[model samples]
Target: MELFAVEIRTPQWQPMILWYTSALNMKAAVRSVEDGYALLAGRGWRLSLLELQEDEPRDRSAISLALEVENLSAVRERIESLLMEPSAPIETSDEGFLQWTTTDPDGNRIKLFQFVAVD
Candidate 1:
């Protein structure tokens, strides 16, 4: 599985991003999240806010964009090799939720989600 280099950048004025994993319908994608969040919530998408505070962040924001990786293990290794400041424990999840973090640079919160092979 090749890692994707996709990155998202927010406008200069608007500085914040709220991410929620959408309940994907595709077959291959849902393999990890078996029986998808059934008991607690139905099959739409559950969203939880990250470290979002109103108390005047820096002149800049926390994160600029995210990086989707091939797997959790690889992503973890790649992040470590980069020698960047880790924000918090990579929100670990077995359902391929996401391994997220914020870098020291601009205190930008970046996310790397494990993705399945397509095609």
Candidate 2:
């Protein structure tokens, strides 16, 4: 079975929405500001964002998402343009993928990668 969606709960509702849309280029498929929820679609996966109360217990650091991209550099530039620093610089994996690791507004890890072209 294929994975469809991942849900993230955060107190930074609008900031998280802006981060996913601008940084990852994900489209806001469903938005319910009144309900404090939003669904972001990227490629074939969907990300669900839900608002959380300040005193709510949330392990934002426990969530991670990896996205396969066609142009790692372009995505990097977009992320940088938004003044968001990556967790680390882009590097190539022994598995033959160029990967960039970064965190969302709420500190969720996001990995962006592209298959390395071998000549």
Candidate 3:
């Protein structure tokens, strides 16, 4: 089955929403402050953030959300504008992908990758 959306439960709901929208350039499609939820949509993916009462985060390291992007430079610029530093792009030519990674405000890993032809 095709994936519909990725959901993140976080205590830092508002900051997470802001970070995803501003840093990753995801569009805020639905926001319900009263309901403590937000939905962000990108090229062909949707990200949802739900408010949680827990102060400590779970082991989210087991899973990371990877995004396929067109312009790595433009995405990098947008990430930098949010004052959040992303890892340097690592080219895996053998694997036909160029990738970089960053974490959300709640420390969820976000990987951005672009396909590249092996020379």
Candidate 4:
């Protein structure tokens, strides 16, 4: 047997969303989030915007998903590249996982986590 290839495959949730309050406000949420998507797209990140139910008490809070390319730097760059610069700068988790949180046009928190590369 021989090695074929390895690459960041699927996304794994390294850390859960730590916020207690749900950032709501749809119209404004999309408006701001759209800016995020446009910036990511510009960076060659194919963004998949999804409406999904969050976990626990925050379940009621709306969420905007960003499924981008599986490169840590790429993921971080696309997010940081945003003109708005997010509420906070991109950060790496204790586990060396890169993470970033932004708000949509409304106020819904949009979290971006990169996938691990593996074959």
Q: After superposition, how far is residue 117 of candidate 4 from its true place, in Å?
A: 8.7
TM-score of each model, in listed order: 0.39, 0.48, 0.46, 0.33
How far is each candidate from the true structure, as Cα RMSD in Å? 10.6, 11.8, 12.0, 15.6
Q: Please state the error at residue 46 of candidate 2 in Å.
A: 1.2
Kindly list the per-residue Cα lDDT of model 2 for residues 1-119, writing each as its tens digit.
12335767789999999999999999999999998989899997899888988998866566666677888899888887655553478998775889887778887767788888654
**Per-model lDDT:** 0.41, 0.80, 0.75, 0.37
Q: In angstroms, how far off is 112's CA in candidate 4?
A: 0.8
Residues forming the 10-long window of minimal summed lDDT in candidate 1? 12-21
User: Which lDDT value does model 4 have at 71?
Assistant: 60
- Cα lDDT tens digits, model 4, 1-119, are 11111111112211111110122211211212322211112122222233222442343225455443356466556556663643566666654445566665565555665544333
Give residue 28's error in model 1 in angstroms.
24
Q: Any runs in candidate 2 off by more than 4 Å, and if so which?
A: 59-61, 64-119
Candidate No. with top TM-score: 2
